[model samples]
Target chain A: MKLAYYPGCVSRSTGKEMDVSTRIVCAALGIALQELEDWNCCGATHVPSELVSVGLAARNLAQTDLPIMTSCSICYSNLRSAALTMEDPQVRAKVNAVLTKKYSGAQIRHALDVILEVLEKNDELITVPLKDLKVAPYYGCLLTRPRGGIDQPEFPTILEKLIKTLAAEPLDFRLKTFCCGGPIFMPQEQAAEDIAFLILKEAKKAGAEVIVTVCPLCHLMLDAKQKALEQRYGEKIGIPVLYVTQLVGIALGLNPDELGLEMNAVSPMPVVEKVYEKMAEEA
Target chain B: MAADEEFKQEVLRLAGPEVLTCIQCGTCSASCPTAHLMKPSIRRLVKHCLEGKKEEALRNETIWLCTSCQLCTVRCPRGIRPKAVVTALKELAEREKIKGKDQAYEELFQRQIKDYGRIAEILLSGEFMFVFPQGALQSMELGLEMAPKGKIKLAVEKIRGRDEVRRIMEELGKG
Candidate 1:
């Protein structure tokens, strides 16, 4: 399966490892990824003006005729939202007036969607299952939102199904689709930390050893800001955040380097080590 | 209540007429995770927008605080998207020159996109730090932590077709 991959800004920079693992997983699954020739930033969460956000996203959409696959959920949201926005005749005309080419509808798929579809097709490909690892699937806010969105916002089962397919225990946490306080992370540290704390606390209470996500922004909030979250809340909730593909890569017996496990802010080694130990014991 | 025709029409154009469907059920406030942190709360902001309190609605810090999470939008029984309304109000605020903390990041993002056609997180943060040293000092711990991992890039790599992006933006009258 060949898809036009859009690895948003985060995956290219701070979240490079996420991008790397996504590529590794896709290759292992025999999927060909053709990156957009020259994609720009999606204007992220805080676009200065509505036109700028729509224009930037439209420019990227114009680059590909194929369905767009994204590593970051925000990129998925922005691109998807932009494509949906262009459906309005007036908005389409207005946006086309500013662009050299007219933007049209493009199917936007998250990395998880691609992963799940692949897993469904080839269940026997999993040689090494992630045994005994309790995973909490964190949807953050963007992945499944803005009415008529890509997935079920209230109860997303895609990640849970993927975790179970990997033979890992998927914990049903209350905060699966909760806000990880992404936009406020930069401006309002306290508010961001508080929201992160709530997520971490709930995941820990649910006995999840690691939190897996598809959004780079959620990974940053839950993984990078964990130490700060612990300090602010004065509690040791040491759950590591891993990209969904990282967990899939591990299950497919891919090398740790290929999965970019070490690049994660909170080390996922402890969780990986436990999974390996459980596998050995079962053997 | 005097209706701010301009504000209401602009919001309706960008965000859709769903804003008028708000029944003031406070579901948005209840659904919002950061409503407590917001000054006027999202419900109040919607009310102010309806009442044509243009200056008050656009200038509020709450307008910029929205994470665009869209929880309020999904949870609202009226099918109104408060998140998009917030974005619409934010655009208005930016046009009116009502500066907020988020504007700093927005300006930095716009500049980076215009210059390179893509954002290098490392360079963007460095530029952000240079622009707001105080904020940098506060987030110094994260910088120190990520430094050892060699994650931060010291150089900027311009995208191949950056000129095309610039031309498009210029066509849009943004340049």
Candidate 2:
């Protein structure tokens, strides 16, 4: 299987590990991720706000003849929203008119939808049983919103299905679809931190050893900020945030480093160590 | 003053005709993760929109802080759609370039969206250093610590669809 992949800004920056692991795991599963050449950003949550047409126009033009895939939840949302809008006759005509007047045509796809489709096709790649692993799958805001598409808007089951396929137990957490305080981190650090704290706190309470996500922004806000949150809240909420690709890599028996597990602020080693121990005991 | 009134009405009108039914239940605020951090509640902001206070709403820092989480809409009894409301206000702000103090952050955020179809850790770290020279040292230390052992080669090498992805981004920019 092959996908035209779009690794958004976060994956290139602090979330490079996700990009690394995603490629490793995809290769192991015989899935090819073709990184989109000269791919522009999806405008995330902002472009869609300022100029919906321009934002969508930018993304729509970025898509080539192939279906585009992205790793960030925000990108997924923005890209998917653009694709949806473009498919509409009036919207498409208007957008295309704008595009023809502006530049050449471009097309893209929602990354999560593509990844989910790939997983569905190759369900057997999850050879390593993850029965002992209890994970909290977070679907942050973007993947499921604006009232449309493949995944449920309110509560999504795609990630849950993916986790179960890996043989891991998916914890039921209230904040699974909640915001990870992403775009707000800079302007409202306190609020972003508070939201992050709440999500981590709830995940911990629900017994999630690791919180898995598809969006790099969510991963950074939720996982990287734990220490600061602990300092402010005087509580040690240490649930590790794992990109969905990392978990898939582990299930394929790839090494932790290959999955970029080291980059997480809350170290995932303890959970990995426990998994290895369980494997040894079972052996 | 009429133009200002017209802009306010336009904002409310673009909000999809549901602006006036806001019951002030605070469900949107309660559900919003960012709301807990905002000085004025998201609920209050929606009320401001309903009241035709366009300038005040656009100037608020909270307008830019939303993550577009639909929790508020999901929880709203009156279907106020606080997230969408904030988004509309942000559009207005961007039009006037009335960026809050964190405008640079917003720009950096947009740059990330524009560069890679998704966010890349290495690139984001580099951007952090470029934007804030003081952050370079800290970013480097963090990068070294988070560097994926043995996987550095894979990242540096081009994957299959890279060229096409780049072309697509260029098209978007030109478009």
Candidate 3:
């Protein structure tokens, strides 16, 4: 059950909570996460050079014989894309020419898949059955994209299914697969906010008590930039945005601090308190 | 038109020829979350490229506006990767040295890749905000908000194999 964990830049820094929660949740599920030693950036499509992006991702891919698992969707896509790019022997040779360790390619998995597989095998892992908590599963564009993967690219049910397994209600969110404007956060700031607002407004309109995000960048858009979105739009969309792992950790009866619940900018305290209240009422 | 055709061929090489299968259904523009913000929507970007308006396709800022969400790529009836097309266009623009915030951000990002092998949120973003004054004020306000929550930090972490990343970056500096 060992996974070569690739915590992308956001998870390591701005989204540190995601890394913490992912580690704790995996450990609780008896999944030993061996972090890739001295992993480089995934290059995240921002780097001008595609070879650099693929090479950097390939560098991390080479570090493991074990399947790679990452929390960030961008990192996941970049790694998988790099693996696909390296499928060309010519491309691999070109990339490997500069590498300290040669990487042909490696299988990469998302933390969602890992956690979902574990929970599907045994439901008892969900100690805190989020009981009737209406959740909006926000896939936010990148999670189920770039074509041909585990979930339906447009109408993904992975997040919904995961929420259902937690004894929570997954709202029929129409905008689940919409963009959170993570890539253009700086370049097109207003447009990015507008895009995130659309998703948030839709989740709110769908009657979601909490919005669950699989990617850290989505969390950054929906959770971190939420307050600014409200101020600009003149709306009180205070719905809690929790990392999917944070929710899973809560359902596993893990401590809030261990999950880095407090580090969330929007304060998933409401979800945290509700978990305790649900526990109390059940008691 | 000949020049535009040459540009289109380059785009085909970079993004893949599937983009030529685009039927101009506007599905890409429709599915695009930020198409409204782009001067020429992704559909129009395709049309311009197909029609051989190289400037409209390459330098119109629409490519830079892409979030790379790939919704259009998934939803395109022709299965065209609009994001790739846009990325290819973006790469072309950078080659042309089209100056703007997007290039600024890219340069900022590349520097991070060179130095630490990873992007430090604060340094990359901080320098970007410093150079590009367009949206920095509000973004800085957001940064200030994130500061006290321990959500962000000022430190930039360096990877153990920094020299290797620098080497790879140097080796690929041509493209």
lDDT of 2 by residue, A1-283 (tens): 6677777655655677788887787678676777766555556665534334344435445555555666766766666556655655654554454342232444454544555567678777665667669999898887777667547778789888888877789999888987887776544556677777889899989998899988877887777666667777899887888888888787778888788777677888898777777777888
For every candidate, the chain B TM-score is 0.89, 0.69, 0.90
Model 2 DockQ vs. reference: 0.30
- Give the range where candidate 1 chain B is weakest over 10 consecutive residues by summed lDDT: B166-175
State the displacement of the C-alpha of residue A58, model 3, in Å, after optimal TM-score superposition: 1.0
User: Over 4 Å off in model 3, which ranges?
Assistant: B173-175
Per-residue lDDT tens digits of candidate 3, residues A141-196?
Answer: 77777765558787789888899899899999998888888888887788888889
Report clash pairs, candidate 3: none
**Winning model by TM-score:** 3
Candidate with more favorable, higher DockQ: 2 or 3: 3
DockQ of each: 0.55, 0.30, 0.69
Candidate closest to the true structure, highest DockQ:
3
Give the TM-scores of the predictions, in the order they appear. Answer: 0.94, 0.80, 0.96
Give the TM-score (0 to 1) of chain B in model 2.
Answer: 0.69
Question: What lDDT would each prediction earn against the true structure?
Answer: 0.81, 0.67, 0.85
lDDT of 2 at B121: 42
